[model samples]
Target: MLRRSPHHRWTLVSRVMVGVLSLLALGGIVVAFAAFAYGRSAARQAFDPLLVGAAQDIAESISIGDEGPVIDLPVSAFGLLSLAPEDRIFYAIHGPDGALLTGYDGIPAALDTVQPRFRDWTLQDDAARFVTVSRLFSERAYAGRIYVTVGQTTRARRAMALDLTRRALFVTTFGGIALIVSALIIIRSAMRPLEVLTRDLAQRDPYDLTPMQADGPQEVRVLVGALNRFMGRLDRQVGAMKNLISDTAHQLRTPVAAIRAQAELALEDDAPRRLPRLERLVWRTRSLGRLLDQMLSRALVIHRIDNAAPTAIDLRDIALTVLDSRDHELLAPGKDVQLRIGEDAVVVLADEISLTEAVRNMLVNALRHGATPVVIGVSPTPTGSAIWVQDSGDGPPDAVRATLGQRFERSAASKGNSAGLGLSIVRAVAQAFGGEMTMATVQGGFRVSLTLPHHGAGQSQ
Candidate 1:
């Protein structure tokens, strides 16, 4: 199976979505980080009130002990922590002597003695986190600094952080998917009018060089209008050209008819002396008429196709038809004519009648000017179709080859009336189809290549 490229599949939509998604992902990352931070702050803020209450209770419960030089805590001290779930509470009291005094004696020291009372400190214990506060009794009765510290475990804070993190991820993952789906829907909807234009265009045939219908957004409407005007102009130009060719043909017919009558009247001379001259005139007149008819017909086709669209032309079938029509011309024994037809379908946007005439003109030129075996081959190149006409003549003189573009003004009134427009017609047709024509000096004769635009006609042929 062959794979269709992304360029051929979803190029426009993918490009649009990539841009939207890049910005959306950036915003999602920023929001996720902010949510993580906010959740952490919430977990921290949730514990602050408990810490303040613990401090106040420890502050109020202190009193002189039964013994001298001491203080005590209320039995309700541990009960302060029971209000908050999963709270790990630790408390300690220290006298001015720096000795372990009351509360959990194993509880570590919490403050610098020189610091003011009511100051709080934080420390990380082995299995718990603690917040400690120190106070001083500066009344005249007792001048000593004592410390009261309160602590709680960090498990609750950590658990709350994990929960917030999950919420952030959950919101972002589902939200991002929703955003993508919504973006697709919006993009397709916004471009829906363009699709209508596409269908309108797809319904048109190659030979139908009609005005494009206008039904789209502002920009597309403008484009369609311009194309329609161009098509209208093209159709008018083609109509004018066909009329011109018909008129030219009609005008030529009158002159050729008059010339034939004059030649026949000249043959009325009973003397044999006038017979050869009269016969030559009649033959030359007939040839001139034939040439004129060919030229006018080719000119009309060229001019029309230049302005209008060309229908699909099967070059392979046309070549075969031409070759079959001229098989005896090419294979007549002793002429040494060669015909090499490659086995591939070469289709192009062209006129079948015009293309056949073009090929016939080439063969006629070869036969008229050169000896056989005239080599005619049809093949393809990198960019287009190429038809070759190589005759076994000495080719044109170097001067004539170099001066091909020069108008043959001096030869217009010649006896044979060869205006050298056969190759020119081929060139014109090629140019109308965005192809090229080239002539190269070959060994025995000349090689003329009538290159036509390839529509990938033989890729799967």
Candidate 2:
């Protein structure tokens, strides 16, 4: 069974909107609670003064009479308490001995000597607010202090507080919703640039690698730049592939045609002369095979140069491996491929496969064009490491040597047998490693060197 990939993706807008709305909802709840508390406190402030006023009026109305003290509660005291029409009012007056002189006896008097105080209590089994006040009176008949207590049911005050709290909650809730909606709209507007960028990319041709216009917010610009860089790399890869295909087709055409023509000639020849023609055909076929192999090798080297990661490579080890290979023994029988090196390990940073291919090609070139006693040497230079192939024969002329590394360009000496890609492959490998290929005539022979950057001792093994 084919397993499906997980589908868990979230959009930036949705995440932002969810986060913003959550914060707004939390803020709205906090604001609603604050409004309720402020409203309740304001309701208490508005009603406390009325209760105090009524208590003071009652205290002032008390007078001295023939019985020692008398109480004549004023109508204004009840009028003041009637401000909250839906509430029941209660009052009490106490003499010096703590005995209720007049009014409701159930209402409690002040305990301490406090002049005025407010409290919440249960009266007639209903929640009520009350204020207590003490007043001093001096008269010829009687001189003492009287206490007044006034209270009322909290129904009307609670109603007012609830109305205020409800209004505040409604306003806060509406404003919070508006803020959320506005935030969403702003988020969408801000994302338009990204949308346009996506649409532009979707509408373009598949092969197009043109850079996009990086105009937007800094974040969007960075994204566009990254996309453009990726496209640029893809374009280079595609171009390399195209060039390789084109070169392969063009170079192989002549040799393949030549092989077919030679085969036809061998077929037409009579029995006695057919052997020589068949031999020529075989040689032509082998040359064509060699050409194809070299072309493919060059292509592989180019591909690796573009894609492969570099590692620590010892040039002496690579030279020994290449010399010991079957192909090397076939090319130069009798152990003619010699190795010469310094004492210390000659190490460089390179891709081993490509570097080996390059060295193999150089050795093949020296064997094909120069005399026997071919030598492969590795040594450490001041800046890097060098791997060279030398042979005992006159090298190409100065003019031809200058153009030796160019693709499909061969010296007059090796034109018929060479595909002219060997030196080019070596050059490419050297350049890939930030190195260079050098040719010089030494004694009576020629030497070609591939020098690469040395890996320092501090680098990881």
Instruction: Tell me the TM-score of each prediction against the true structure.
Output: 0.46, 0.68
Residues 274-345, model 1: lDDT tens digits: 777677677767666655665575666566665556777666676667767854454243565566776667
**Hey, what RMSD does candidate 2 come out at?**
6.0
Best by lDDT: 2
10 residues in a row with least lDDT, candidate 1: 405-414
Superposed by TM-score, candidate 2 places the C-alpha of residue 353 at a distance from the truth, in angstroms, of 3.0
Model 2 global lDDT (CA atoms, 0 to 1): 0.85
**Which residue runs of candidate 1 sit more than 4 Å off their true CA positions?**
1-8, 11-26, 64-71, 74-80, 92-129, 140-145, 164-184, 226-461
Give the alpha-carbon lDDT of every model.
Answer: 0.67, 0.85
Model 2: lDDT of residue 280: 83
Q: How close is candidate 2 to the true structure, as a TM-score?
A: 0.68
Model 2: ten consecutive residues of lowest lDDT: 2-11
Best by TM-score: 2
